[model samples]
Target: MHLSIPPGNMKGTMEGEASPELKLEGDIPARYVMPQQDRPSAAAGVAPIPVVDLGRLSRPDADGGAVEEEAKLRWALETWGFFMITNHGIEASLMDAMMNASKEFFGQPTEEKQKYNNIIDGKRFRLEGYRSELLQSEGQTLDWSCRLSLQVEPEGERSFHLWPKYPKSLRDVLLQYASRTKIIKDCIMRALANLLELDEDYFINRTTTRARALARLGYYPPCPRPDLVLGFKPHYDGGALSILFIEENVGGLQVLRNGKWYNVLAKPCTLLINIAECIEIMSNGIFKSPPHRVLTNAEKERTSVAIFYGVDVETVVEPAPGLLDEKRLARFKKIKAEDYYGTVFEHFRQGKRLIDTLII
Candidate 1:
């Protein structure tokens, strides 16, 4: 309820002044120009989106428990649809003070960063908006970069009643890093229901049942023309799982498949695990939801945060009656998580084609 953006919508359309301090290099210029739908054409290779590490799942030394973290969290989510968490214990100075409070709230002054402007039922959180080339069709471009989206969740009522206001020492270091990222998102959903073998209190009581975390933060900036523009376009993560945290030697994140774009090689304190589409429809789809993107930089500037972790807009997500009783077929069809979030944002506001209209 504490919003404040005046100063005449703090002018923007790139005038002059400001826009400095960005110097992390290795071959800058947004890493070799790119933007033909984030050009991937090498048959998008690199294992869909796998990474898993979570400090080799080892919970038990305080007195020996949970059998070697349930066999390395079930062989790293059955061979990764993405993973790389570490120790499942967060606090690298609360992820460097939540990445230095997301570059000090996107470097303030855009009218005090649009006084936490998020609209939700009206949808208006733009934060540097730009993505309308007939919505880039297959490339659906529009991600030079700049975010802040918040919405902690029901656990002691997280944040985001409107926008970004966490400044009480960055909201007590992001609520103690969201109370240790809600106990590592309930031990990664009870290690994804014991890696599909189910019955671990069936995902440890669905990790606080009606859950619904959120947190974006991103930044990118520095595209003076990094190959004509684009540092986030591809797509494929409507939400049901996500963690991210990025930045350990600066590397443009990527993840597409059978079409090319694999560079997600970060590794400092770790955390990336994706697997979305409501956890690929509560795991019945056998964990997939790949397709990711983010690649810009004329020289430097690329902060991340992500968070996601879903299951609450009136939760429904079907298909697990014992994986539809020996595959009698029902891969995913009980819908209503608000109509799969209104069909992935009404197909991103009818720019068209986001598919996946619940096909169980």
Candidate 2:
């Protein structure tokens, strides 16, 4: 199903009345300024989240690495629900090509970029092509970033019209990127099933069959008032999982764990995986989905490619039957995948948790 951007989310909030483009200049406009209490501070400054080696995890059990790797995956999932992977097998040339395509697309003239405007038929607002954050209130503070979002999976569902063609290699490069990540997604899903003692393909069929994959390429330019604005607000992802490639040298991503926020730093060769609310529900609270946000850079611009994956809009979402027993009960109520998406998008705009209303 095509999930339209909610009523108040699009329209005149960022770009002039037509689309959600964020036109930034000298000092940021008043609407983009965040409340003082929400400003960013110095990062926690250490190795914040665990870094998992995918190569070891993919090894044969007899090699003495898979066992230990599985244990580490369990720890990362249970604790932070976020981690970076090394030796993930996506070639450096392909990774570089993807980022370069993103840079070239965003570097185009505004009018050139508008050809893929996300607003459809000048009425409904959607999440493909060029877009900005959703506004829950009329005068809501804005995120400091702009993005190009496109649906990539279930080939039949893809809107090729929304995909950029200016970069020449953009379409092919993204297709290859998505293809490679699909393999990793399968590998991890089986590992998760193994950890839970369910069939190794348990998560595979539930998510991959008709899943929707959205590739969001984000651009966060250097902000004049980095302390007064935010690149993104704190919210848990609504999908099952997300694999991200950020501008490696620049620091902007952070995750909230316990009572504080920690930096999620990584190199160009590594990609970060974040568990989302759906996974938390599917795992019956065994896995965590931490709230994360991006801070604007003061001296340089930052960019990221985040692909969100989830069950088809028609699937049913709830704790797995195998996960529920006499001692452990369902912590979340059952909801259709479409309604789950609606609720999650609304909660994101309102800056709240979907689980708060879902908990039993």
Candidate 3:
């Protein structure tokens, strides 16, 4: 459906200039219309998102292969909260087709698109959008994008009820992506289990049984003055983990590290894996849940697809006792996942740093 950026909500109005207050939404536009072919005019460059060749880890024939894979996974997690993965075992054509369908969905006429608005249908919780109704408890400007969400329900529920209607062939693309991603996610979780010295089945079973798989198909329409709007504001994803397939050549993703923002430097065929809030909590502060944001383009529009694997909302979250020694345990405490999430979410609603509230 046709959605517009609120009045005066520009992204980078003060880029490279210094100011204490973040212009959270400066002159946000009143209307946002999706268009095809929206892209950044100039190429922004940086070292790419760190890449891990999973193939090296996948070779069952290699000597000490399992150990090698665990080490790589640990290194990647410790350094960057995000990374690109290769040899993920998903077909290239499938990815291409999914991207195409996502683009088409966002490009549809407003009337047609609005037909699927989750908010309007009273399924606000399950509906995908930049804003979450749960967080409505604290009023914040709605995020500047629209998205569609789907889940593989309990009992391998494959009913169309969970998936949105799209032109023919689009559904196939999404299903394939979801299925393949589950496989890669399983692989990554197993490696994570090894790193934690927990049973391989621990993560696999936790992830799959309570596994919550959802996709956000985003559309950032072209802005007259791109610097004035944000593709997305700086924030951490609230989930167990996330896998993102960003649009090729549409630069916007940036992550904060060492107090400076680093361009994620995305590329086609590279899948970005990001640690969510839950992972950080489980790691007991060893790994970070870095804040990330997307800058609006000065001259073009942008779009992206993100699939998230989250734990069941009702699940209790505490430091995985296995990962914490007495020394580490002393430095941290346990809290239910829902409570911790609410605390962080409240801080963000006031435009404050989410981690600052929970770390202490």
lDDT of each: 0.59, 0.79, 0.62
How would the candidate models be sorted by TM-score, starting from the highest? 2, 3, 1
Cα lDDT tens digits for candidate 3, 221-333: 55554544456666888767888988768877887777667678766687999887777776676666677877666555667878888765566665677776766662345
- Estimate the Cα RMSD of every predicted model relative to the unseen true structure: 19.5, 4.6, 7.3
Sorted by lDDT, highest first, which candidate order results?
Answer: 2, 3, 1
TM-score of each: 0.31, 0.90, 0.78
lDDT of 2 at 298: 67
Better of 2 and 3 by lDDT: 2
Q: Which stretches of candidate 3 lie over 4 Å from their true place?
A: 1-48, 60-72, 121-143, 153-159, 338-348, 352-360
Of the two candidates 1 and 2, the one with more favorable lDDT, higher being better, is 2
RMSD of 1: 19.5
Candidate 2, residues 102-209: lDDT per residue as tens digits?
888877766677678786665467878786654545558778777899999887889997788899999999999998988888888888888899888777877874
Could you tell me the lDDT of residue 94 within candidate 1? 78
